[model samples]
Structure formats: C-alpha cells, structure tokens
Target: MTGVPTGWRNVLPHLDYDLPDDLPPQSSLSGGVKVNLPLELLRQSRSRAGTVEIPGEVLDQYRRYRPTSLWHARDFGEAVGARVPIYVKYEGANISGSHKLNTALAQAYYYRRAGVQEVVTGTGAGQWGTAIAAACAVFGLRCTVFMVGDSLRRKPYRGTIMRLLGATVHSSPSGLTEVAAGAREGASGNSLALAIGEAVEYAATRDRTAFVIGSGETYSILHQTVIGTEAIEQLAARHAEVDAVIGCVGAGSNFGGIAMPFFADAAEGAGPAPLLLAAESSTTPKLTRGVYAYDRTDATGFGPREAMYTVGSEFAIPPAHAAGLRFHGTAKLLSAMRHRDQIAATAVGQVEAMDAARLFAVHENVVPAPESGHALAAAARVATSGVSDREAHHVARRGILVCLSGHGYLDLAAYEEHLTERLRDESPDDDLIKLATTALSAVPIEGGHLRVP
Candidate 1:
C-alpha cells in the first residue's frame, strides 16, 4: 500500500460493491466455443475489499509521476463567465499524457510477476496501448497492441510512440486474426470492441500470453482509485467543496476513478457527495441513448457479457475525432450506478467538444485531448446555466471539478480538422441506431434480468 490517508481505507471496500454477493459468471467465445472466464480474475473483480496493495517496484516506478497536479482554472472559468470556481485535474502531466498509465503499470507488474512474457490488449485512441507498451518496456516484457483500424490510420503518431516503446502494434480488423479478417469486410470504421476481439483471439492461441483490457472491468477501476484518492486530499488541503465532478466516459474508468471516492463519503453519510456527471460522444451515445441490458464486451462476442448501457457490441459507430470515447458499452459498475440514479450523463457532439477544447486552450493555455474536451463541454454547459440549481443549499458560490484526463499534443490534427470545419458535427441517423439495436437483439443474454431492444 502506498500510504493512503486515514479514513481512505474505509472507502475502498465499498467502492465496487454495496453488498457481498457471488460474482456473476461470464462466457467468452473462442474458436467458435463458449468458455468461462478465468476464476482468479473474476474473484478479484467481485471482491468488495477496497485496497489492492501496490507492489514496491510498481510504487517506485509510479513515484516519477503518480501524484498529478490539480489546477484551479480561474482564467477559463472567467472566460466562460462561470459563477463558480472550476478546478481541472490534469492527468496529462505523465509521459503517456493520459490517466491510462495508472492501471497500465499495475497490470504490467502483475503480468511480470505471473511469469507472462507477452501481454496483448486493444486500444481505441492508442493512449492505453501506448501506456501499456511503455509499462511493459519498463518491466522487461513484450507487448502486442491491437489498435482500432480507424485510429491506427488516423493517429499514426500514437502508433509510432508505441513502436518506439518496443511494442508491436497492429491495425485491428486487419488480416492478422481470422475473426477480425472476416469482420473487416465492408466495414467502414473500427471500434474498440473489434480491436478487443482481435487481441483476445491472438492471446487465446498462444502460451504464456495473457489478454488484458483497458476498461470495463472492476480491476481496472480498482487500479484507478488513486486518482480519486489524490483528488480528495488535494481538495481538502484547499478547503474546497466540490459541487460536481465531471469526466468523459468511454468504458468509465476515469470517471469511476474520481467519482467512487466521493460516492464512498455519501454512502457512509460522512459528507455531502458531489454530483457525478459523465460526458460522452454524441456519435456513440451509449449513456444517453443506449439501453440497459446484457451485452458482449467485444464485437465478435469473444468476452464476458456485462450488464451495462450498450449500443450493441456489433454497432458500427460513426467516426469521431474523440476516438477514445468510441466504445460500445460502459463499465458494468457505472451502468449499475446510472440505473440506480446515482449518476447523470450527457452527450456532446464533436464540434461542440472541439469548441470547448478551443475555449479551454485559449484561456487555460493547455490543449486538452478531444475525449477530455467532452468533460469541458459539460462543464461549459453547467457554467452557462449558472450551476446554482444543482446544489441543495443554494450557496452563493459554486465549485466544479473537471477531470482533464489527457493532453492533446498528439491530437493536433484533430484540432486542425475542427478549426477548419472539416470535422462533421452530425450524429448517426435513426436508421443506423435501429440497425445496431437489431443486432443486439439477436445475441442471447443469460445472467442479467434487464433487457432492452
């Protein structure tokens, strides 16, 4: 354990589960056969225990960049004419420039301890892949990243960085895997689900190789709690009360990381909880328009079926500049929280998100990743609305905390497209959404009681 503050340990056990129960069984399809997931990982995912001890070596490595800085965005707040103070937790200060590294290092350390020689995983915007690749290099392990085809083609720099870290990067839905090869036919864009399928397929056929996922799992969320733990302490030192905490959601790792600690306070009746908000891409509005149901975690149905808000594993989402928010489903725990009315979600189009990013850059002097811009967009929306009604006591002053999950130095092209108005603001039509729902209806769901079509 990396010396967590007092009372922080009390929040850990309740972070994932409110009650003790058996972990749900999940089925994975490989070689046209359905197989159960490994029980070891499943047990850890279901465990209610809050804290996972960080190994000494992992902690030593994290010392280089772990406690990210939280900045009070006074200038940005002034430009937005916000009546409240805005704080940005900048996770882009690290080498990989994203919060993904928080879990990547932890995962790599576990793989090295288990004697695994290689780790295979999927990446959408390439941040997770880059983070994991860097982590593997530090731990003297090999990494194979199956990057989403669209992202691989559009963000060549991300792939270059991963390669520079000594990781093998392949464009997913390519000819590398039989399943991806078949699925690539006539497909216009690549999704996180498709990349996951490719990674799982490759890992299943090899020995001493393990498939790791960047998000949508409890362990990933557990590894991410450091973000919230740090944020709480930082805010306490400033004597600030957070009215709301917002973050962009793909598989909900970052949002869950920051929000869960506050939720623990609410759960224990220790303090008033901050409003939890998730910002998502309008192109793939899983939280805003998706149905709560049991859906496969991967495109080819080669992973566990999670109870989440999904647009179907087979849904073909329109390409957006915020590639990191292109996943089909959210984390199961986040989905459950939304279902229980514990969180609120909203969708922002690429154009609006870009506009928010530009406004942030001009005032804050930091270029935010397009995915993180979604949270900025949401913050802007709240600021524009005065942010007073959301509070219970109707205080004279208000505070908003936005999780700037990553920097966008590698995403200059995306900003250029937005500035040039080449990026489309339109979302997929009703017909496309219906097509995705229809595909989801065909998949058989077993464990979850809720179904949406």
Candidate 2:
C-alpha cells in the first residue's frame, strides 16, 4: 500500500481564475468588528501555495489512520450491471466516523499554537462536532459545539459521543447567543448556517475563545486535500485508469478532499483528467438548481460575503435523514469549479440513496454513511448510463472512483427509519428558492469575479 502524503495539495492558485477576498467585517451582535479567528488560518485562506507541508504533529496523528483502504467493488459492480470497474475509497477507518477529522486536527493544532484556550463551532449530523471534540481532547483545548436542533434530536448518540469526548454541545435556536434568537424568529430556525452565526457571535463576545469553521471555508477545503493526494498514489500503485471521481457534497469540503488533486492535475495538463461528479440530496439544491450569487456566508450576516451557488442563506432547510446534506449553499471553491464547467452535479432522492446504501452493504459487507450513499447512487448511474464521451472518442470504460466519506454504524437511526419505510423525499420550493436568489443579488457585489456570483 502507498504511504501517507507528507504535504497536502492546495488548488487555490490553479483554479484558472481569481476569487474575491473577504470584505471589511461588519459589526456582529456582540458589538465587535468580527469573529475572532486564528491569524495563521486567516493567512492560509489567502495563500497561493501549490502545496503546504503538514506539521509533524498533524502527520503523526494522520498516520494512525492515513492510508485508508481503496478496494475494487467488483461484486457490487457486477450486481449493478456496470460496464466499468468500480473502486471505492473507504475513509471510515478514522475514529471520527467521517473525513472531517483531517481538518479538525489541523485546525486544533493551529489554534493551540496561537495560544487559544477554547474553540467554538457548529455541526450537522454531529460528525464535525465529534471530530473537533476528539481533536480538542488531543490538543488540550476546550470545545463547544452548536449542532442543528433537528439533527441533535435524530442523532442524540452523536451529541453524546461529542460530550463523551469532552465537548459541550448545544442545540441551535437555543438561548445561547443573540444570533440564535434571531434564527428562532426567522425562516432558517434550525440550520447549519444559523449555528455558525451563533458560534461566531459567541466567540466574538467571549475572551480567549476563537470561532472555528467545520466546513465550506477555503482553508478547511485546502486542508482536506490529503484524501485526494493519497488516493492518487494508491491508484498509481494499482495501475488503475479512472474515468470519473465522485463524492457526496455537503458544504463541499468532503467532495473537495477527494477530487482536488485530480482537478489540479487536469488544470496543469499533467495527464488525462477524469470526469468529476458531485452528488447531493434533492432537498439541498445548492449545487444542483440554486443560483450562483454573493450571499452572506453565515446566517444573520455575521460572516463574510461569498460567491457561491446558494438557495439563499435564509431559506428554510428541509429535514433530511442525511443531515449533513441539508446545508443551503456549496463551498466557494466547489461553486467556482461548477461555474467553470469543471464538474457535474446530480441530486439523489432520499429513499433512492438509502436503497443504494443497503445494496452496497448487502453486496460489499460495508454500510456507507447516508451522505456517501448519494455518491454510491451516482456511481451506479454513471456505470449504467450507456453513454460515452465524444471527447475521448471511445466507448471504452476504465474505472469509477467513489469516495465513501464515512460509515453508517453510528447512523443506525437513519437506517431504521428507512427500513421502516418512514423516510421520504422532500423537494425544494421554486418560488422560495427564487426569492432567496433575488435577495442575495441585491447584497452589493464587492470584488472582481467571473460568471460566478
């Protein structure tokens, strides 16, 4: 097997276009200028380095579960009548039960170095909270998480896991912060965005506490490039030729982790580039049907404005079994890629995605996370599409790489709901989506950008 990568790939400078930097901070509810964050992280967000070396401490922690297994799903491919080989990169070996630990450890290390005592953040489905909680325990820092109220109710065990890891968890829309108070009266009563706003306000109002983001930030996505870089070496050792790389999109970091290297190679003309696909839930229409615009990054306008494909930061988030996929906007980098036609996105129905997870479990003896199930379902579609790319001028199918971002063992509650036929699909409102887009358009554009925002 190939070893872990010493450095994480950074595709920020190679995106073929420049992205806007954050504007001056608007005053938050705490009567502060902005959220207090680690200066190193803020610098990294603007860095154009092709590759940043992973600190020794972070590397040591990564080695414990770095080289995640990548197996050829021949049995599942045959069962699904695929014409190409299906390879799955399973990342469930990590203790966090998801790929989020990759960034959580890096952030915690940076925070601890910056002389920060405590970290505050938000979570969805509790994976990011659990990850940050464990990282804080390792780094000798305190963690506080504001999880979506709906997600906390459905996955109480996840919150329990975070608490067991020594984190203090709170349900969003609670009386913790004034931002959450606004959320309680707004359309986005309980959402990842609202929780982020609350976390930012709390951090800004408190001393020695910094607000850390779990996903959708530029630095967070850059830190996750290890997943894609390692997969590159593993595929080379196996001599596997890939035609497509697929992953489920929440705020986009999970998919970015596995596809950044491939996309970077394509931009550099290093070799043949595979088709990139983003799989998301139909309920979260950000990457699929949402309009690209400059929207507030967090709820209540406490964060910077970013150009992304968003269904408006104020839209009522639909409750889906895959809570991680309930976010209303895609990451800035991922939205940029989509705007440039560098990737394709497809929405999967709730029931259909769970069935795909069950099929994979029955055939491969592994239960994928509900979010990853969307990618698995997309892989099945690509394999059975019977369509060929004219650019390649050949009907030859090579392989499809699926990033199984996490495991479903801790998410049995969702599976139970699905098995009992209680899970159903929820569709987005066209008029409401249009309303959100229109409001974002009037937010006043800040800097130079492309067809993106």
Candidate 3:
C-alpha cells in the first residue's frame, strides 16, 4: 500500500498509508468475477460497431461535477457522543442528490465507449434515473427511463428534470412493452411500478441499447469504492483513524463499495479492518436475518445468480417505504464476504429509521432519505454508549461511515404522510416470506451449506 495522501493526512489524525502517485486501475482479478468482455471492448470499434468516444465536452462537464464532498459530522457527534467519530460521504450534495451517479457515470462512460447509442433503465423513486439521464445528456447519448408510475405521479419534478435533460421518460405500465402490458393486466391502483427488472431485461434483449441497473450487489459495489478511497483520504487528512465503518445497505452498493477497500487493506496486513456493518430495514432485513441461499433477482425467471440476503425473488417484493431496498436478493460478491465473517449486519424498523432521519435533520441540518437513516441510527446507538473504559472505548472509538446515498426531497410526500398519520407501518408479511422461500427453492445450483431445492 502506498502512503496516505498528504491532502488527507493534514485534516485527519493518526492516519497511515503511503499515497500512490496515481489512482490504481481496475484489477483484472475481479474477486470471483469473470468479465464477459474486456473493459477495452467498451471503447473499441470492433465492439461498439464504430462509436468512438463519449465526447470531450461531456467529459469536461463531468469533471466539473465528478468528485463530490466528504465531511466529518462534528454536529452529529455532539448529539450522539464525542467518543465515536462519524464521517459521512455526502453524495446527497450531487446534482441528482445521491451516490447513484458514482455507478451511473462509470456505466455511461463504458456504454458510450462501447458505441451504445442509447441507455435504458428503470427507477422506483427517480434518483437513479435522474443521475443516468443527466450523464446521458452530458455524454450526448439518448436515455430512456421507465419510472414507477406511482413515483412519477408523486414526484413530477423528476420527470420534468428528465425531459429537460433530453431523455425520454415514461411511466411504466403505460403499455410500451410486454412488462407494461402484464402490469396493466394485473392492474394495481396507483402503484410505484417502474418494473426495474423488466426494464433491464428489455434493454438487454435489444442490440442497440445497453441495459443499466440503478443498484446491484456487485456492480455498484465495484463503483462505490471511490467513496472509501475518498474517505480514507479525508480521514487521513484529519489525522484520524476509524475503528468501525457503518453504512445502510439497500442493494449493497454503497456499503460494499466503501468498505471493500478497507477490507482489502486488512487482508493485506496493512492494518486492522474496521468492523464493517450493513444496516437494512426490518421489513426487508435480508442480510442480517435472511437465510443464505442462491436466488434470482426479479422473481420473473430473469436475472443473474443473485446470491445474497434478500426478502423475495427479484421479480417480486413486498412494498416497503425504502423503495430501493425492496430487492429480493443481495449481490453475490457481498454475500460471499458476509459468509466469510468479514462484515456485520443489522436491521432497523421503519419508524425507527424515520425517527433517525428526523433526529439527523434536527442535528445535522440535512433531511436524509429514509434509506440512509438505518445507518445513522446504528451509528448513533454505538456512539451513545460510553467509550471511556477499554470495553466501552472500543465502542466509542469506532469509525462510523454513512453513505448519504441521496436526499429525501423527492420523498417529502412520504414524510408528509408520516406526519399526518396517513402512512401505515408495513413490513414483509408472512405471504411475502412464503413467496421468497418459494423463489429460493427454484435455483438449481447450491453452495455455502445452504438448504437447496
């Protein structure tokens, strides 16, 4: 490992590491993954059928907004405690107000390089779609976004933004495709139904478009390391070292991405790895409470070998407030790490998560998305406990990292509902569990000592 970055060391205390002169390139040995096509193929004429680049202007625009802000939550500490130091990588400050762009930008870069003329994707709450649509606008590629109809009706600002950015935005169940047709036939009222899996499947089946997913276990996990890389630098600048790192996990992108590098460092004997903890909603506490199993993503008989802790099959999930965390399974890569006992997991109830968000807003002056409150609450719990004694100090000295994934502006309606007592507390019902177990039984390949079909 190279020495710590000088810029970071100046701000953080007791930091260590040699800072490399250049950022490391993506490793070919992709941790139990095989690249179906060399990354270079993304940019070659042979692969793209002759598209050359993402355009210099777009690259320049991205450079303006590329690297985002990181901060030590000093105020958060005052309320929680002084012992546990909390640092947050505030992706909420980004244009789309979330870390979705971290992966979206990379995917766009690859797709444009691959000569893909169009990008197709789906969004439940619209953050991912907004990020990708913005990236496509900059890259001069056409973007097609399928938004869950309910979210579209609720968050019109997102749709307006997509159009202004020059992308085609459609509310799913609009009868544009078979997925929409099926949804219409099924006919649920005012549903938040972008049909993410269906949208991705449609894009993948096309030769002209590259399918993009907002979040997945591994894909986003790979991109989120940038957060860890930056945080490590920022903490080093502060001359500080953290004992634990905590983040909320929906599809496992933000948490896995940021923690993996530290885990790698520990694996290399560089130092101790922070106790990595992933927080999920009790309604969909797949990681901490789920039985490990081989599973499918969309439950629709599509998706990869999504090996992870998930509530249901990908195609189907019980409705939950944290819209993004509704996926059926986790990323296979993150799941493996969990099995190896390299990370810890926890699940918080919806009201608790919401209360955490309110507390954070009152203290930190930022209204966090409900998804992010899970980690915030977890970190707060750890910080509140005394750390003066060795046993308690261990708890206090922990480093808490929150991936402020996105702002909750689009979700204000939900918040309003919460305040008005209009929203009912809901969770994974027994029927949902039965559905999930049934989906798990469909997978043929079995490993990791899990019960098989």
lDDT of 3 by residue, 18-76 (tens): 11111122222212221122264222212212112333443455455545566778887
TM-score of each candidate structure, all chains considered together:
0.89, 0.93, 0.79
Candidate 1 vs candidate 3: which has greater lDDT? 1
User: How would you encode candidate 2's per-residue C-alpha lDDT over 1-453 as one tens digit per residue?
Assistant: 899889888888786677644554344554662335678788777778888889999999999998889989998888778899999998888778999999999999999998888899888877899899999999999999988887788778888889999999988876878777666454444588888888787877777888888789888988888889988888889999888899999888889989999988877887877888888888887877787777777776867778788887878877787888888888888887787667778889878899889989999999988999998888888888732221222222788999999998888888999999999898887887877677554323334322322
- Candidate 3's displacement at residue 161, Å, is 1.6
Question: Candidate 2: what lDDT?
Answer: 0.82
Q: On residues 80-131, what C-alpha lDDT tens digit does candidate 1 reach at each position?
A: 7787888898889887889999878878887777778889999999999999
Q: Give the Cα error of residue 287 in candidate 2, in Å.
A: 1.3
In order, candidate lDDTs are 0.77, 0.82, 0.62
